[model samples]
Target: MRKRLLTEVEGVVAAPVERVWRALLDDRPAYEMTTELGDHTVAYQGGWWYRGEWSVTAHPEGARVVLRVYNVADRLGWGVPLANRFFVGFGARTRQTFAEGLTALGERLGCPSRLLP
Candidate 1:
């Protein structure tokens, strides 16, 4: 079976929900956000792949921009194998990396970003 992992990130945007929603739904900005380093690739409902290393699917629920990211890097390639293994396997490092990616995605979507404490 595929490793099933799903996460939800919620935040309040200073702008109106519709405005924020439009910004996120725009193809160009959405594409840019995913292709940028450290940002996951967001393949829209029926969009094509090839923008980024990983795949992402975006859905808007009212004011919330809910994204599902797939094929995230456990360990980026071309590095010290041992070190990469240690870090990626560690819970703290993994969580931090994922959090950072989510924060970046939120910022690109014009939302103030924060990690849940």
Candidate 2:
């Protein structure tokens, strides 16, 4: 039996879509991309086990990033959904992690992005 957590949060970037994409995604050609957090590619656009589904879309004068992290589990008969709810800390941490990542991405790209609360 196993369990996982999934959290969904969105933030706005005050830079052009292309620029934001390049910065956060290392200039990947497609919207589907992976994030390198040290040696682990824990974040991805397409979703993975215990990982996250990361998406980027263009908005007026900027872009928006959406993250959904989840996993399948058997911790109980209730499965991953119940586990996720019980572990609220994971969601909070995920939010902060993504927020920081977005901020760092903007800095690395040389175009600052404002994270919408």
Which candidate number would show the highest TM-score if scored against the true structure? 2
Q: lDDT tens digits, residues 32-94, model 2?
A: 654444221235433334546566788674788777776633334355555556777877888
Give candidate 1 regions above 4 Å deviation.
1-3, 27-62, 70-117
State which candidate has the highest lDDT.
Answer: 2
In order of appearance, the predictions have TM-scores of: 0.33, 0.62
Which residue pairs come into collision in candidate 1?
none
lDDT of 2 at 39: 25
RMSD of each: 8.9, 7.3
Q: Residue-wise lDDT of candidate 1 within 25-113, one digit each (tens)?
A: 45344333434423323342222211122333333432433444333333442233333466565435545664675566567765664
Total colliding residue pairs, candidate 1: 0
Q: Supply candidate 2's per-residue lDDT for 48.
A: 30
